[model samples]
Target: MAEENFETGDAGASQTFPQQCSSLRKNGYVCMKNRACKIVEMSTSKTGKHGHAKVHLVGIDLFSGKKHEDICPSTHNMLVPHVKRKDYLLVEIENDGSLSLMEDDGHLKTDLNCPNNELGKEIKDRYENGEVLTLTVMTAMDEEQVVGYKLDNK
Candidate 1:
């Protein structure tokens, strides 16, 4: 008979081999590649009969504010989660409903809710202080580029 070693501790159970992944899933242990991810949802599978189980995870990007989901691995190595990096900073807030964002390369300002541009109803709310907004991505420019524009016709 083959000797199997299953380690259990404060983190639950620890399996030293790959075949033991099914067991880890049954015990409610989900593997994570990015520990820094903000877990928005955690769901377990109800299909396990003896030693087959799985977990699902849904997470959001702290920087870009995007959502993503994936299946949990049974016995995989977990990597450290990358921290959300802020490439831009909120600078001066204009009198109008627009604001300026300063990054390492440039400045960006826009009135997303302004009328006559979108050809319809107003979409953007008036800019406010301490509001973290995701600026439009200008992939064509380099990181050192600085941008300056006006919200209203000036």
Candidate 2:
């Protein structure tokens, strides 16, 4: 793994571009598009005049990881890789908070159990909402992550 580098923005220095990375992992979402981007360090600098804060994101290369000062947004939209959305059902939520989802193929399997303590609140909410039993599936555009939804609607 490459170490995160920190630096100040100097006019003469080289720069890197900002890469759109996943904020969610197993939760849901996919790397629809990917590009090499170098991480740039940013900090708040105050001028004598009061003004709104501004954000500066720098982009860099995938291999060398050299920092650049000037960059333009990617001209092309990123393509998210995905397929058709599938449906599933919620069979049970264990005391452990792990969730089991039933597939259209008649298979009941664990999808994701949040955590034991965290599940009590959700279980109760689901029970009250008439969603005690349900199904869910990953959206086609974001298959990397799973989305829990009602199975009855299907």
Prediction RMSDs, each to the true structure: 15.8, 15.7
lDDT of each: 0.39, 0.42
Residue 95, candidate 1: C-alpha displacement in angstroms = 13
Each prediction's TM-score versus the true structure: 0.31, 0.38
Best by lDDT: 2
Kindly provide the TM-score of model 2 when superposed on the true structure, using C-alpha atoms: 0.38
Off by over 4 Å in 2: 1-77, 115-124, 128-132, 139-146, 151-154
Q: Write the per-residue lDDT of candidate 2 for residues 77-152, one digit (tens) a residue.
A: 2223333346556666677667677777787777565333433466546755766455344333222223335435
Weakest lDDT window of 10 consecutive positions for candidate 1: 139-148
Runs in model 1 deviating more than 4 A are 1-36, 46-50, 82-154
Candidate No. with top TM-score: 2
Per-residue alpha-carbon lDDT of candidate 1 for residues 1-154, written as tens digits (9 for 90 to 100): 9975565332542222132333332223222443223457766676566554565766654333366566754444433222223434445545563545666667454432222233111223323433343433221111111122223322
